[model samples]
Target: MQGGAQLPLPNPDSTPAVPVSGHSANGAAPGPVVQAKESLLAAAAKARKEKPAETEAEKMLREEQEIMRNITSRKALKSVMENAQGISYTRNLKTGWKPPLKVRQLSEDQAQDLRDRFHIIVEGENLLPPILDFKDMKFPAPVLRQLASKNISRPTPIQMQGLPVILAGRDMIGVAFTGSGKTLVFALPLLMLSLQEEVRMPLEGGEGPVGMIVCPSRELARQTHEVIQGYITAMKEDGLPELRSLLVMGGIDMRTQTDALRRGVHVIVATPGRLKDLLHKKRMNLDVCKFLCLDEADRMVDMGFEEDIREVLSYFKAQRQTLMFSATMPMKIKAFAESALVDPVTVNVGRAGAANLDVIQEVEYVKQEAKLVYLLECLQKTAPPVLVFAEKTADVDDIHEYLLVKGVEAVAVHGGKDQEEREAAIDEFKAGKKDVLVATDVASKGLDFPDIQHVINYDMPDEIENYVHRIGRTGRCGKTGIATSFINKNQSESILLDLKHLLQEAKQRIPPVLTVLEDPLEELRELEKASGTRGCTYCGGLGHRIGDCPKLRSQNREQQRNTKDYFGSGGFGGET
Candidate 1:
């Protein structure tokens, strides 16, 4: 109980013995334990006292750093996964297996004469002689039969040059009139590429699509898919390895497309949007994609698919042959081609953006209110299978309804319609079940309605390029067709002037209304002749000069505005 009383000895039978050293029963020194506890407490107190409150800037920095870390982790994981998948799919594929370069070498004078015969202008290094006949290209027997089946006894001007350029494993920028059989130029080469890969080692699950065709619209994509499928079927029937082609586009169930990819597609005809989506989701890849065709590439860029196209290109695991085909070769396309293609052959069937000479472009001035009424009159000029293009969706619907009310067999397609409805309308029109296919510019680019007797622009498009494409729907595959445009005061004078020049260039009759308009491009044309240049080379717009290019100016203004906004919003840590 007291210090002195504790000195009494305990009973030896029941008491525990005390240690002689200054240590606890657990054998740890008590001084160090206490000192360590005190030190930790002191450090905690010191930290609390010395630490400053986090400022907003510091907090934001911390959050940004954390976000960056997470992003980096995800990217690393994706890179690893993509690498593994790439290796797996390309494992059995033979590397550097190029198709035999079966080009017909010709003298410069002979080549020039051949090009002149078809109105073709081929520009590139080591250019191959244009194939005068389909048989000269050494296409597979099946491909030739398919061509024959399609009634294509000879190569179109574009096919004449483009086929040789592409089949020689050369990247090409094919600029031709809209109906110049541009599809075959890329489609046939794509088949050869796919067959080469498939026969060597057939595609398995999670593997190919050795070739891809990117279209701006689902309709174009489906049409291209059908074209490829036809060739595939012909080849298969000829005892060649089966080549599977898949149509990848929006408005269809993604699962179906994914399943097809899983089943190993040898060729994919896809719209930019859906293809990018699938690539982003990792449901498909470009690991084995050796051939890339951008059909209606300018239209895709106009539809704001430039970023998507670039993003899709970033997904390619290997260097692939790229092909860009468009009716119009604006400066934008030229710039894009410069960056995307490797020493690409520029095969121009005619002057870029020229209206097909095969088309009879008849521009008639009509009052805006009278356009609908005049549409019927225009339709009477041609038989069934006419394409009526309007700029606005509402206008397309109105035209479709009016035609139907007038007992005209019409089907309408626009962005407003569901995918199924659009497909159905297009199919109906193509099948000749409908006399008129009323549509927006969606049907203008890269749609081959071979039998379209006429194309009537219910409303003139603002851009002459659209006019070219709309009129090009007819007069396809070497057939003469008529195009009647109802222009009114609502149409811009710039476009009217362009139309006048276009008609004059084609040697078509220009209306008095367009003739009355001042020729602003006349002086420009004279200057271009002096300098070996033509109207607004940037946009291929005949109405304006490069300095006055509306599109280029608009793009510049947008870029400046975006930069200003970015700085104004404290993008670089400036005060708002």
Candidate 2:
């Protein structure tokens, strides 16, 4: 909090850091349910493509589309949706997005707060008028002095930790929740750095993105770009160069992005994969960028874009100050930060999943057969507009179908649906045309539905990080959100342990169910045998081999004990 003068930049060798995780770079098989959905989709695709005749271009496009269909990460899906240009192609590209805001732009008051924040950092003291740094940060004064303030009074722990390092122009990795204002950690520095250089127009040969942000998802990309624009534009009208920004995601026109790049912009926010495609084709350049950022880095690994991110990281100047931010620090992201940051400072804003603090979490252990009834009952009594999450596209479909049959107006969105359908469904939900949106994890990250009051985990996520992301969809922008999970009899102790850690950190109430259950996501052997799969290790895997087939083995051990009791003790066993 003291001596805010522009902090010194890190050693020259440092910078251009990106949160790089190998999770983004692999070829892995789909989850069992996802595999089943793929099978269902293959039949659906076959039926949809009834016409046998096709041009070579058409065939190639279809193949591309099929490959894209297999990618479910919202960011990956958005990359594809943003690329479709033809009418059907465009519709096909629709990875349902309703812009976060439509009416108002950044207010002058908001813009001034940004300027004042920068001044406070650069001078290590408030200019002329003079105020305490702690006080300035506490109430909206510094930022609110102007009209239309985008006031964020107090800096979160992460910001307080990294603001000095960023002002110093040092590379950094921030681990914090989605709503923790991690965006400003690097953004403020980059804006200040931009002020040091001469503002210029786009150059010829269609090159150079001065400030580029590589994000895991298009929704994040779009949102990040808009946030940057808001901050930069506010600076511009106040007498600085208007920060130009271009959005490059998966789905829209490549030509349009190319044109935007060629026309030149001050900053570019993009999805790693699509941005790679553009860069490989020499459609854009990173040579001039003095600053780079990789946001939602942990999620990128979840979406499988590590290689793309690495490749893109290579494009930036080695010394461009890099700022990498993520919600969690999994091994993959940690490795990326190690490789990408140059002796960078690591700032974690609060506990990584601290947003869980304001969230009230509950888990219900119910029979799968009774899931629908329980879900409906819970919503009818516990809350309204509960965001139900499923593990697979098929589950979303089944839930949607069942909800409709029960006269519940529910909407569903997944990777398998075309962009238009996804968009239509999302729009309907936003417009209140639908009461519940049954979705896969794609809806969990970077999408804001302010009125979302509750989140239902129909299928608990294998990764606890995902659980954090799902709960974030609600309780955003300073509001509280509730999350209820449905854990079946067969689920995992690991999940409970993870939940315990999250709950302890977030200050949320612990459900008594955490004490009684194994992994609900796990299947019982009996259930699996009956279903011709395997009983869930959680409930019994009917035949589904998950992780390493640990649940099934446990079930087998239980069976042996039963056999021992009958044969040795009762002397009436059928077999020893």
TM-score, every prediction: 0.80, 0.62
lDDT of 2: 0.61
**TM-score for candidate 1:** 0.80
Question: Which candidate number would show the highest TM-score if scored against the true structure?
Answer: 1
- In terms of lDDT, the poorest run of 10 residues in model 2 is 86-95
lDDT of 2 at 246: 85
Error of 2 at 407 (Å): 4.9
Off by over 4 Å in 2: 1-151, 195-207, 232-240, 353-355, 381-385, 404-409, 423-434, 504-508, 517-576
Model 2, C-alpha of 237: deviation from truth (Å): 5.0
Candidate 1 on 234-300: residue-level lDDT in tens?
9999999999999998888999989988989889999888888999999998888888899888788
Return the lDDT, model 2, position 157.
Answer: 51
Backbone clash total for model 1 is 0
Q: TM-score of the candidate numbered 2?
A: 0.62
Reference-based lDDT, each prediction:
0.79, 0.61
